[model samples]
Target: MTGAVVAGAVVGGTAVLGGCAASPTAPPSATARADVTRVTVRLDDADALDDVVAATWALGVEALREGEDDDGTVVSPSSLLTALAMLGEGAGDGHAPFDAALGAVGDERTDAVNALLAALARYEGDPALVAADKLPVVPMLHTAQQIVVDDDATPQRAFLDRLAAGYGAGVVVDDLATRSDALDEFARTHTGGLVPTSPITPDPNLVAVLQDAVVLAAAWKTPFDVALSGDQPFTVVGERVLVPTMEGEFDTAAVSADGWQAVRLPYRDDLVADLYLPPEGSAAADDPSAAEPTTLAGLSTALDDAAADRVLVRLPTIDLESTTDLMTLLAGLGIVGADLTGVVEGSAVQAVQQAVLQVDEEGTRAAAVTSVGVTESLRMPPPNQVVLDRPFLMVVRDTTTGWPVFLAEVLDPRAG
Candidate 1:
């Protein structure tokens, strides 16, 4: 939405962080299903829960920008902590001390923000790159690890139990058979409605110690309806076709340049989504070869210039689903400094080797599930009318740090 555009240039220095990497070839297909019972659990502290929620949101944002829209929001910070507290046996009032310890990690937070920004820079056509005076938004980042033991039970149960405990309230773990099933159950239980779950294949031996990271999210308080969305004509690359449309009044700051417009869409639910439109006869539309070399940094400068005003927004009601390999994305973000070859290096669980080693042996299997719907109402009129119906980039970002963990392109709204 429309707000003061803070003018602060992000420093150009860079640093490398260690993370996971996927193999060049795809893994073998495995089909396994499990139906376990639902369990209730909790976390030990608020701050630890907050970090989980925030990280999930960041990851979701990157997924959205990467073109995966399935219809679920990341888990909130408060709910995650509550879940952790419930599962931790003998956890009393010590949550406060845990929170204090988390708050003291200022240096880690700074490093996280830097790493994320570097990641965001890899997006080829970011709208923020068009802005004149770029503002640096720094977000705090944290991580936690835990182990659950049930001598008489399967390792899968331990993973599911910890997952149930991490969600706090507003969630229930159910029908868990394998480690992948546990992850799917966690996604279904926390999401407000029925949403599809991403597939995961965990090695049997590493299942107990290597928990599938859980993420929860909540949509904007006011959501758009699919029924209200309609079909409108959109032109992309000299091709025009009818596309689903959603038009409504939204307070947004827009940046305009010679032949392009960039708008920052802020949802009432505390998330920011950005959109970029190319002007008629612009290089993006005229020369297909030239578009490949365009950088987000250049677009950010244009956005700074055109983002000084608000307008009536008319955008297509888009529904999408896609998958991303985390290792490739992180490497693009400059996280190559650490030896990320083992599972132990990138994961919270200490049992597995580094992610790289895991990929070499058992293989690394990680993916995200995303869904987005936006509808616009025409009751109010503004000085300008903006219609979005072409191939454009969108990103969901954390309010604290401008870093985008999820990134994607709306190539064709009509496609499944």
Candidate 2:
């Protein structure tokens, strides 16, 4: 079904929050830096932060469970929650579903999300200052949110207002089908080129897209020694693979309980990567879904009861990326058929997330983008339709010489 865009342009005199005004230009990059300004707000109530953390971890675990890849999986709970929270704000009759899915409602959820954003703001810096080849000595986390609507579509004032106030989100009015390159630049600018393109594909029926992006680069408080790094055997879904591994003993928070061992590897600042390992030889060790749900659900409590201590560790240097369609996942969370009349009428929701993470002896760097697109329920036919649903042979050839450049059997899109 196609959704309808509400009539009329945004009224004048609307306050732009977070000291950054929305861009008047049609190109997305005009406001990219402005959108990343550090949000200034009193921290939300502790209860709100707690609720948000719980919800984030819960969703992160589910994302891994739903992923079928054995190579690895990565999900940015903060990016996902930030985008979804904006969607929740625009939900009219569909509000309750987002509430249940997020485990918070009303001002609680709003404050929770805003609070999380504010907290993360402490680490944010100019994305231009970062370089992938050299991890910054000073930690940085760049985050920004924006709502882009088709120039022809008029957005609701109240919905936009809430987003500006609660999320510090900027608004962009551009032609989604033609101005998509601008959106890609915005993503690249915010993510320091870690993710160079926006995940949202423009469709004739698309009206609006809510986007959140995060780029993190930080050094470990205690860097792993390069001298100690060497090739080692590591288990990967049962098979042992010899990979470059980093070995070290460092002071960190750790806990063992309910057939799990976990540790918090601290960054130079507040950020940390919490690694949880399932019992060796158990199915859960090989598969994320095999673990008991409570193992992840009570992770916070378990870690809270533990104290920081020196722990010996061996970890592989790694680089991983994943792009996932979260429409089915959101539906599973009770957000099916969302009513986003607060933004526009007849809206249908589509969510996509892309994440990249790298870890080495120096530290860790990661980036993620989450996009929730709202389109009309009634749609125009796509310009092209190509579906590789069945097994088939694929070939890449030079048109002039009929010389095959590459060829392969087509099956399992997930296969590498």
Candidate 3:
């Protein structure tokens, strides 16, 4: 299979963008290696730090908006952003759309991605040791990136170098049409088997495929009492249904603002889940179509400005998994007809993402796999008697940089 045929299958009849087109950059030197293994890429952590965080936060919000009608949904902005950052680096002059989406310009995007990856890298470890059914005393956040290429193809050295530098991504040479099992194993290994299959299919017509995966297993600082958990009626799109719920009391940060109440629950390693519950009878709570909730910044500020105090909390045990066609969302961001001559000649990209998350009385376990064939793609709390019996938003993020890893809209705990 060829790159165009593989990309074409992913994109269908979507029109490629017109402009400078793919620049005729020089190919790798004869001696340049194609079997690039994963290496630690050292990057300055201070570069474009804030811009990257905000950009990824915006990406999470967009995903929530796109899935408003679904009973529940989850998206990993960090996973999606990582994959996009790799693809964006290969866009050459066609980086405009990516820059706009990432909130960085020119070489700034590179710095932003590197800095973001560096920040997250501090927590990467063994996902196998993470316990999903209990609060993990040692939380685990694992990330892996790879460039799967046709055995006969040699990706550009500059492109590979950028990926290594910014993402620590490795190169894997395989027969795209027949080695799909390898891709599946990669996904299962990286995600701790939460996501058992790869999002991108192995196609003979493909040159190189970019992949990013993230797994987070964390325990809440204060575990809810298991005996307090029970089945109860929860409202979903104005309808009521029975779901397993957990009740607890703990000292946490919370605030009420703009017809919404927000709470922050701490996890190990400065990670937190921020939950936002719309005011009762509000448009958002009553109608799923009115998906608007407070912004990420607003929720963050409200939680920050509030004092920690003992409050009662009631939340449902959750298990959710989703596979998203990210091109549907990227089209809204104007990421069409991307110029990827930097990766392969005459290449346009398409992407997909698979994600799974579970929340129990002990803690949370979540994993996301984002694959770009050229494609690509919380919390909270309350003490003070906050019963989340209706629709709400949850964001799980690293407190050190405020970069969201998982964002979910829980309209019904029974739906995944």
Candidate 4:
């Protein structure tokens, strides 16, 4: 709710990421009013901007590397973005590595992120924004923010205030030195119960922790007909795995290019899920490089290479859960090796990412929790009758913000 305060005329068809919307409004909190100036900007078009999405997939690849197995993978770039934005806000804008990791340089980076978060804010607490009407099934939605500072530490009030206003983060000074359970409780409540177990621990040397989470349980804009879902065989590396598969013909975004096929399945809200499959031995499925088929950058070509069309889709219903410790991955990616001593001295941070994704005939119920110890951090298409029976990739993101909330590669749906 804190991020939705942009000022400007409402854009029709699309919800305005500015000043107002048809949803009920609340005056900025007493702590928020002073920083209200932060929200008056306009984001004419955030979906076209791939910075967040790109950076997110970059992190998702990091996750892909962490779980080297095939239980299906998921990552929340929005949560990581919010946490890094907090770190970046405190780390200052000139930190080149931090800037690069965020896929934004100078104010442009933060501004782009702000635009996206603000759009999310507009839908908070509004049923129309969170809940999809009876399209087949309704998804429950969850989005929250909170910051917990060790009781022994004192942080700059200005740093706290900026994040609170810009990101709608909640500030809590807690005794991490002793009672870490409270932090766990906070995480569960903030995520609307998507994350019941805490991924954080007390660090006596730790100064502060900033976090944000996204929990979505909404039907696909085009739900699979439940009656049609049944056991189907999915091809994996060594053998084929039989799993329950959902089927339907959806009018959505899809593309077929030189070596691959992709599609976008939309959520009822501003977010969507995308799937990509590469031709055998193709660069995408075989050798994923900068042009890795699963990367957000690669998906951007969906418009040009793959067009929106009606396609019959038959996908396995999967219930996947994963936990990724990203410190090693980030260090490998060179995004977390930056020296951030100026903000928090000798800071040792580890990012632990937890995610859950369940897809059936009804909808997807997914949630992600990014806890920085200092740790950190889909699609479509076809009317062409694309059956995801082989190994493929998946990603979920905001249609407007292009924020990649979940990304994964399903080598086998039965792994869970």
Which candidate gets the maximum TM-score versus the true structure? 3
**Per-residue C-alpha lDDT of model 1 across residues 66-126, encoded as one tens digit per residue:** 3233321111121122222222211122223323322223223222322332232222121
lDDT of 4 by residue, 5-117 (tens): 10100000000000111112222222122242455335775432467657766765666656545565666656666666666665543367667776776456666776776
Order by TM-score, highest first: 3, 4, 2, 1
Q: Tell me the lDDT of model 4 at 338.
A: 55
Alpha-carbon runs more than 4 Å astray in model 1: 1-181, 192-198, 205-229, 249-251, 279-310, 326-382
Q: How far does residue 27 in candidate 2 sit from its true spot (Å)? A: 6.1
How many backbone clashes does every candidate have? 76, 8, 19, 28
Better of 2 and 3 by TM-score: 3
**lDDT, residue 295, model 3:** 61
Judge candidate 1 at residue 307 and give its lDDT: 43
Each model's lDDT comes to 0.31, 0.56, 0.65, 0.57
Q: How close is candidate 2 to the true structure, as a TM-score?
A: 0.79
Candidate 2 per-residue lDDT over residues 52-139, each given as its tens digit: 6667656655655555444565566556666677778878888987887676887778877777666655666766444556666666
Ranking by lDDT: 3, 4, 2, 1
